[model samples]
Target: MGMNYFHQLLCRSSRWERASATQIVPWALKGLDLGDNALEVGPGYGANVATLRTRVPALTGLEIDPALAARLRTRKFDQLRVIEGDATAMPLPDTEFSSVVSFTMLHHVPTPALQDDLFAEAFRVLRPGGVFAGSDGLDRPTFRLIHLGDTCVPVPPATMTARLTRAGFTDVEVHSAATYFRFRARRPA
Candidate 1:
């Protein structure tokens, strides 16, 4: 994951944290049951950890950056475990989590192929009938500007259903606004 210094600062900002807690997480997870075990992919700076940990009995964060993962571990988020690993190839066992979520992080995966692999990995870790949900911003000028010198292959909402379906997901639901998109899908029971 490539994070420019400016982007890193923005992610750690209070405004971003507040929006993640009050708006982003809730909007992506509306009407979704996170079940007893939930995994959050790419939880940079752990901005959403506080809110996500509350929704699920056990919440694990899978971060690719070792420093960020260590940072999260030190924060001592109750009911949260920080794991340093790539989402495309998580080290956890199969059929582990009941739900998988990634928020505003897909574009950082560098390529659509890896992003699709992450989707498949989420399916691999989820038990039968498990849900995979999250939100990502649509490609826009401001989004690209913040990601200058970083990996930013934005996932276009129109292509989401096809991609998730290719990863063996069912009940795929994609909702998009002018700037961002939210999605939900289920692994077949």
Candidate 2:
């Protein structure tokens, strides 16, 4: 239900952070389309918020941390909508977004049930054909890996596909490299 400290240590290490700048950002950016309305979960530090808004003018950021949400307000991103809410229980209506993207936050979910809720919520909010891409550091032998305040769930490609199918998403694709795993799924039209 929580992140392992060791994984956090790995993420904070200079080498990991440096490598992420090259590996993670570009891959995450590929999932977003500027013309579509988007929703981001756990917009930590608002790092990707600016880039997201540039592509999807109606980009909404949902975070559970009040302090981070407050800091996000400092930017005059007129098109950005920042909301304080749980990813497992979003406030918006169904079919509310054209895309839903979450990165490195899946492992932070307290439990697998919560993780299921997150996937369900994302599906509920996405229009048919809407894309949902979420990435996490789970290239481990067990679910004991940790990153920052998140836990790696040891989700391989098959498991990820099954999880997406159970959540009512079709055409699931799992792309991974070393410490990164990105699950790209779509609501069927």
Candidate 3:
């Protein structure tokens, strides 16, 4: 996932980390079980990892960007594993995780079709009755400015719901907030 220089800086900023911890991640994950093992797809810069680490027993991050993944690995977070790979074609095994999540990262998938492939991968890697939940920034002017020269493909809530269903997830839910959208889907038990 390519990004402008400013965009990259913003992602690594302390302000973004605080906002993700206090605002985005909590709101997106409220009431979610996240079971024993949780997988975070495209955890750019590990912004959501702090809060998620508190929520889930074991956390694994799958990142497309090698640098970001390596940086996370350097941190040596307790009970966290950083994997460098594409979410659309994961290196992990099937029915492996109790939950699959992404936060403020789906838009970097480049295309809607590839985003669907990511969804399918989530479904594939989740155990029966596992949850796939996440939040994506909405398509807006300010974000567009920051995302110039970035591979951003906004996942509109309505369209995302359809995509999740097509990926064989049941009980799909997509809710829009002021700046972003939160989605939840379940692999049938």
Candidate 4:
């Protein structure tokens, strides 16, 4: 499927709505010291952005979809900036953010290599002792059907922890539940 079509499908799907809900954001970010400022990669329609702002007063969102990014900018959340960019190659300074977070978006990166790149980029942007936290769907027939023809790499918790370690993150932790996996890794100080 095309990128635009996938984006449209995500926006229309009730499942997507439930998965990207603000309530879930807190759970994904739990226990991490996000500090004062944070960055969210691939915040689909800015659902996580709204909740993240409640925790970290200063937040920036990197969205791959230009249209969605434009729409998010219209909301004009205080201390929130929406930048349209690729997750693997963010257009921001190094060690600028206190934390980096993503919610159920890594599978959309098309390949494991790209996903690793995303992890590295998150590490590159975060300050020393900062956190990189997120959650992603587990590999399952039902979850595979949800993506259908689209690109989805259901990364397991173990694999995710390895990738985080390879990407130069420390204190990696990956927790697996029934349908999804949540992870947290720290950049060394």
Best candidate, lDDT: 1
Query: What is the Å distance of residue 165 in model 3 from its true position?
Result: 0.7
Q: Tens-digit lDDT track for model 3 on 157-177?
A: 889778899999999888998
Please, what are the lDDT tens digits per residue for candidate 2 over residues 17-107? 5554555655865654523788988875565665566567688899787766776666635657889888999988999898998877786
Give me the overall lDDT of model 3: 0.91
TM-scores, one per candidate: 0.97, 0.80, 0.97, 0.89
Ranking of predictions according to lDDT: 1, 3, 4, 2
Q: Stretches of candidate 4 above 4 Å error?
A: 1-23, 76-79
Error of 2 at 144 (Å): 6.4
Query: Per-residue lDDT for 1-189 in model 4, tens only?
Result: 124466557754667655666446666777667898899898766666656766887989998878778877886555488888998999999999999998878888877889899999999999999999988888898888767667677676788778899999999988877887889999999
Better of 1 and 4 by lDDT: 1
Question: Which pairs, if any, clash in model 1?
Answer: none
Candidate 4 accuracy as lDDT: 0.81
* Model 3 TM: 0.97
Residue-level lDDT of model 1, residues 1-189, one tens digit each, is 888999999998889999999998899999999999999999999899889878987999999999898888987556488889999999999999999999999999988899999999999999999999999998999999999999889999999999999999999999987777999999999
lDDT of each candidate versus the true structure: 0.93, 0.74, 0.91, 0.81
Q: Which stretches of candidate 2 lie over 4 Å from their true place?
A: 1-22, 29-35, 76-79, 139-157
